[model samples]
Target: MRQTGAVDPTLPPGWPAAVRPPGAPDWEHTAVAWLFDLVPPDYRAHEVLRRYPVLLARFARDHVAAGLEAARAGWRTVRVELADDLPADAMEAAITAYEREGARLASAARGVEAVAGALRGERWVPRL
Candidate 1:
C-alpha cells in the first residue's frame, strides 16, 4: 500500500475526516459526497446532486430558487400564525426552528446556485 500524505489544505476544514465506506466506486466521488454532506441535513441538495448529477450543473437553479422562496415563506408563516396566547419563550423557540430550517434550505439552494454559476465559468466550483 502507498503511504498517504497530509490532507489538502484548500478543502473544507474537516474534509480529511470524511469517511469513505468500503467498496466505494471511487475516492474522488466519495469525497464529493462528503463535501455535500458538509452542508448537513439539507438532504435536498445532496439528493439533487445525486439524482441529476450532470443535469444539476445545467438545470435546477430555478427549482432551487423557488424552494428557497418557499422555505422563507414557510418560516414567515410560522411567525405570522403565532397565537397571542402562546408564551413568548415558546414563540421564540418555534420561530427559531423555522429560521434554522429556512437558513439550511437557503444554503442548500445557494449550493445549487453555485453549481449553476460554476457551469457558467463563475469562480464557484461544481460539486459534481
Candidate 2:
C-alpha cells in the first residue's frame, strides 16, 4: 500500500521549489492521508489495501483532467482580462472544453467513491 504521508522524491524538471500542483494540500505528502478520514478503521485497513491501486489510478486521471480544465479556465480569464481582445469563438470553445473535462473529472471522482463504498460494503447512492 502507498503510504499517505510519503513524499515523491523525484520532482519534474523546471518545477519551482515553492510551487505545488493545484488541489495538492501538501507537496510533501500523498493525499491518501486525507482519505483515511472517509473510511472506517477496519475498512481502511483492508478495503484500501485491496482497492488502492484502482483508486489511485482513477485519482491521477481525474487530477490530470482537472488540471487541464483549470489551465483552460486560466487562459480564458487572462484573455478576458485583456480587454476582450480574445476571439469570441475560441473563448467559447475553451469554455466548452473546460466543462467537458470538468465533467469527466467529476465522473472519475464519483467512480472512486463508489468503488470505495462497495469495497466497504456500503451502498453507493448516486446523487441524480
The best candidate in terms of lDDT: 1
Quote model 2's TM-score. Answer: 0.39
Query: Model 2, range 31-125, lDDT digits (tens) per residue?
Result: 34433323345645565443564464344445545665675676567556744665878777766776776664554455345443433445433
Q: For each candidate, what TM-score against the reference?
A: 0.45, 0.39
Query: What's the distance in Å from true for residue 66, model 1?
Result: 3.9
Candidate 2 RMSD to the correct structure: 14.4
lDDT of all predictions: 0.50, 0.46
Q: Residue 112 in candidate 1 has what lDDT?
A: 50
Clashing pairs in 2: none
Output the worst ten-in-a-row residue range by lDDT, candidate 2: 10-19
Q: For residues 14-73, write the lDDT of model 1, one tens digit per residue.
A: 223333322334643543454354433464455666664444433444555565687678
